[model samples]
Target: MLLNLNKMNDVKKTFDTINKIVADWDPLGVGETIAEDEYAGYIPEIIQVMKNDQSLFEYLSQILANELGRGFDSTDMKHVEGLKSICDKIIRAYMDI
Candidate 1:
């Protein structure tokens, strides 16, 4: 359906944005050691997208599952939880909008 396609496209765009942010922060990609300060700068941008796009949570959840499937460790899980917490805070802030 066209609606489903649009949702998928939105999710893909969000994922691409996340990938670009991570790549920009650490040119060597996710496995690289990025400075916490540098990485923190992009969290707002990601949270904005999640606040704007309802499909993003679903996409993010799937990505988290894939990462867990690949044997991601506790640190990765904590990072994911932190992101979800931020998303939750943003959602609550704008729930009436």
Candidate 2:
């Protein structure tokens, strides 16, 4: 049971770290204009994609574009592109756990 507890703790830690990363990105500008947790709803999905070793960039881009209620364009692409680093950060963080 100790091992299971440790795994649970690691998962919680990863979730918290990724949550912060997503909030920092503030895809909806909510951190500055609205609330900090505005993007909290998307974190679980992001984590799932990350854990599954899926295409984080593509998944994030789609989520961002959908939330912004617009078609994926150059500007939007560029904005989301900035978030690509978070993917690496998350991977490193997860590995460390």
Best by TM-score: 2
- The best candidate in terms of lDDT: 2
Question: How high is each candidate's TM-score?
Answer: 0.31, 0.71
| Candidate 1 ranges with C-alpha deviation above 4 Å | 27-97
lDDT of 2 by residue, 5-94 (tens): 999998778777777766776656666445346766777777777754347767776875786664456466666556566677767766
Model 1 lDDT, residue 42, Cα: 47
| TM-score of candidate 1 versus the correct structure, residues matched by position | 0.31
Go through the candidates in order and give the C-alpha RMSD of each one to the true structure: 10.1, 3.2
